[model samples]
Target: MEEMKRVLKETVDRLFQEMNGRFVRLNEIDEKFGFLLDLKGLIYDEKDYDLKKKCNELGQFYVSDIDGNELDE
Candidate 1:
């Protein structure tokens, strides 16, 4: 009976550790996705002419369409 109790405890502890690791990774991914969505919305609000000029000056490339695709200038 004592050995059985020890085995059960070890199993539960391993399962809890695995779950904690997954939860932490998921939180990190959610934060990154939220930041990208905000940035895309801000860029969409600007006028096309202004965006183009800014891109040229900054030497960075960006898609003017609704899609948020960026390329290296």
Candidate 2:
């Protein structure tokens, strides 16, 4: 798990180094991470995750599109 996290951080840093990753606020990062976890995609880490009533927990805050793009607010 630590290795996975390290790889992810390295990937983000490398990508930002390659281009522009603007300075987003901490609250915005929280919102974006929440958006990612709450995203309903064609693939699921757990097959029965939907049956667990998780999205209901997310409520109005989970509004990103499948591609993780923010829709009009």
Candidate 3:
């Protein structure tokens, strides 16, 4: 029982470490693609958009794709 518990603990620890490593890489990818790049507000910055869909819209890149590319008119 003690050995089984030790093995389980080790396995859990390894899994957690692996998850942490993946998260670090995920952060890098997010930065590369501007995903969650700015956590200050709920939305992204205005400059990221190509056009302003609404007059009251705050951000420029309000309408964009997965890669942050603005939509064409």
Q: Rate the local accuracy (lDDT) of all candidates.
A: 0.55, 0.50, 0.52
Say which candidate scores most in TM-score.
3
lDDT of 3 at 44: 47
**lDDT score for residue 35 of model 3:** 32
- Across 1-73, the per-residue lDDT of candidate 2 in tens digits comes to 9999999999999989655544455556665445445556324545754422334434445545322222211
* Candidate 3 lDDT trough over 10 residues, lowest sum: 64-73
**Winner on TM-score (1 vs 3):** 3
lDDT string, candidate 1, 32-65, tens digits: 3443445654566545324433334333322353
lDDT winner between candidates 2 and 3: 3
What's the lDDT of the predicted structure labeled candidate 1?
0.55
Q: Candidate 2, TM-score vs. the true structure?
A: 0.27
How far is 56's C-alpha from truth in model 3 (Å)? 28
Q: Write the per-residue lDDT of candidate 3 for residues 1-73, one digit (tens) a residue.
A: 9999999999999999999999999886664444333443325445654233332232333334322233211
Ranking by lDDT: 1, 3, 2
Q: lDDT of model 3 at residue 23?
A: 96
lDDT of 3 at 49: 46
